[model samples]
Target: MLDDNLRASRQTAHDRPDLQISFEFFPPKTDVMEEKFWDTVHRLAPLKPRFVSVTYGAGGSTRERTLRMVRRIKAETGVDAAAHLTCVGASRAEVDDVVRGYREAGINRIVAVRGDPPEGVGKPFVPHPEGYRNAIELVEGIRRIGDFDISVSAYPERHPQSPDWNNEIDNLKRKIDAGATRALTQMFFSNSDYLRYLDRARAAGITAPIVPGIQPIHSFRQIASFAARCGTAIPGWLAERFDGLDNDPETHALVAAAVAAEQVTELVDEGVTEFHIYTHNRSPLALALGRILGRRHEVAAVDAA
Candidate 1:
């Protein structure tokens, strides 16, 4: 009887036909990367994502490239572009000027973050003396500069350098209070972790829409290294799914698509209607997953060419 009830509940959650997805891309560092980035954008923008975000690099080193990509997307694509702005090493005046620059470029959304330092993750964070103190401070500054829509990050297993889980949640609340309108969690493997985080956020009076960030694990070695750096644990079972297929690229791609599609299906069963996919400037996997979930690509039908 309990099993039957649980099945019914899952079906009820997945029955909702309306769903939304967004994507995140990094600033291209070179000509070849730039071509890949734009082609990925062209391929996936047809799905009409809620908003496509371009990430500013650590210490804002990719600031100009990010802004250029964002402005071009705003001008050429049908999707809204959210420019990421980080508070790590820049002064308040410098950050403010960047905000104004976005406004002048006709971009109106910001993904505010307290970015990692040159020392990278697992290192202590030292706030810049003249910069905005944190992501919350940066969000507030954006609000003062313009009527921009702001989004902030949420950590499910807690940030690596955070003192405790409470401190992490408190920091999220502070960002929302400052001016953030939505939250996107760090990439996680299990649905239960995201659900529990949502439960705790509700308990703490957080009501903003929280989008789960999804990464399609395509390469085992690369993903494992990235998981270690971001503090996201890779379950043994998950690793086993791709085991022994390392020598077979075709089999690996098929396995990757199946696994990613299954993850999103399970998330939908858990009442998750929104997703944010990290596209490492490659969209075939994401595009395939979207088609699997019944999202239609609308690009060629409405093109000027």
Candidate 2:
């Protein structure tokens, strides 16, 4: 009965107008990776993600690579590009230069963040003192430099550094009040984590679309390591799903696709119309999920939007 009511609720929600979906990607670290990255780009471009983002790397380490990919997307792809800007290791002037470059390149969307400190996640964060203090500060600074559409990070399970969940919620409120138009959560595993986070967000009076971040898991070890750093809790059932497949790459791929497909389909069933995927530059997984979701993108539709 609840499933029926929930399904009916989604049908009603669908009538309310769907919010756009987008994805985030990291710049390739090698030549072979570069080829794979663009192949993924070409494959997903047809999906008409509202915008696709390139991740800003450690202490600005991936700055050049990320810039190269983002500019290329703006030049060659059918999708809008969002550049990630972070506050770790970069001063105001340094960040300003990057932001100005993106503007000149005709890219207008940004995912502003207080990036992980150069040391790494779980390490203490030392603000540049001169750089932005947090994501809110970064958003304000970006708004001042150029009229860019800025998005910030949201942690559905609470960020690693937050003293409390309310602190996390309050931080998000500050980001919104400071002008972030949307919030993309760090990648998560549980659908329930996302739904409950959204509910708490609304109750806290934060009205922006807190788009659930979906990471298509290709390797159990890698994803688990990532979830640990990012504060995403992997349920016991998920761990069980990947338990015995450590040595089987082919079966792992099949299982990975199935799990991601189920995640998104369930979210779609639960009334979540917008998605932001952390694609890690592997399009096959994201593509498999898209096809399962019935995405048959028409060029005419993309051009018209």
Candidate 3:
């Protein structure tokens, strides 16, 4: 049922052992959600990701929860955890204090972002009168506080606010120049978009790793809605694949796995060796993706040996 080229690509990915992965999670708002969050974390921990990151909510609404979750994850799981820091609604001193908190907590890795305006994505981002103005300033502020391994956001398709590729790539360059060690792109459905963005970034002299962010289609409808909100284009073909399967959970799950499999394998074939998965606090699809990327549970492998 598979074409030879795609099948060979899958095999090549499985055989190559150099691939690296990371996961993103958000702070749980409720007790029930907290239980599910840990379940997801434990389920995917065996894959031994390079690091796991917890997101800070808009306007730092979940700041305390984000810090608590990241600390617990590192302390309990022994996995290096990164915290997301943003410049949306906090003054410079306040933001710097949070950075100090992360340093004190031993969270040395940070995902520095100019987060969505408190109003929401696509809304105008007005900096706090006394806060870091953008991601560049946020990265600089984080750098001043500690020697953090900072990561910033990139957009495969230009960000909604960026008027052109020049502006987009330049912004990325500035972020990296400030202190960011890596760039993690926004979730994109098209590999070509990512590849092209990479080429442009390279052309502009960005030498740091621009890791692709992979989003598993946990729910097609929900993901589509997110894509729309974030300005990510959904290909017609992708839409057609999920088209009449809204009520069929089983089939939808199968198709979701297949779609994500094809996407990552193709990237692997194109020489992409690093990935950052947005795990919306779920495990089945992320676990399936780990297997497809040739990662196995360390304990299971050791026991088998």
Instruction: Give the number of the best model, judged by TM-score.
Output: 3
Can you write out model 1's per-residue Cα lDDT over 14-100, one digit (the tens) per residue? Answer: 256588889999998889998999999998988888899999988889899899999888778868999999988899999999999
Identify the superior model by TM-score, candidate 1 or candidate 3.
3
What lDDT would each prediction earn against the true structure? Answer: 0.87, 0.84, 0.93
**Per-residue lDDT for 103-187 in model 2, tens only?**
8888899999888977788888888867877888888888888889888999888898899988989999999988888999888
Ranking by lDDT: 3, 1, 2
Q: In model 1, how large is the Cα lDDT of residue 143?
A: 94
Structure candidate 1, residue pairs in collision: none
Per-structure clash totals for the candidates = 0, 0, 0
Candidate 3 per-residue lDDT over residues 36-59, each given as its tens digit: 999999999888999999999999
Candidate 3 residue pairs in backbone clash: none
Better model by TM-score: candidate 1 vs candidate 2: 1
TM-score of 2: 0.91
TM-score of each: 0.93, 0.91, 0.95
Candidate closest to the true structure, highest lDDT: 3
Candidate 3 total steric clashes: 0
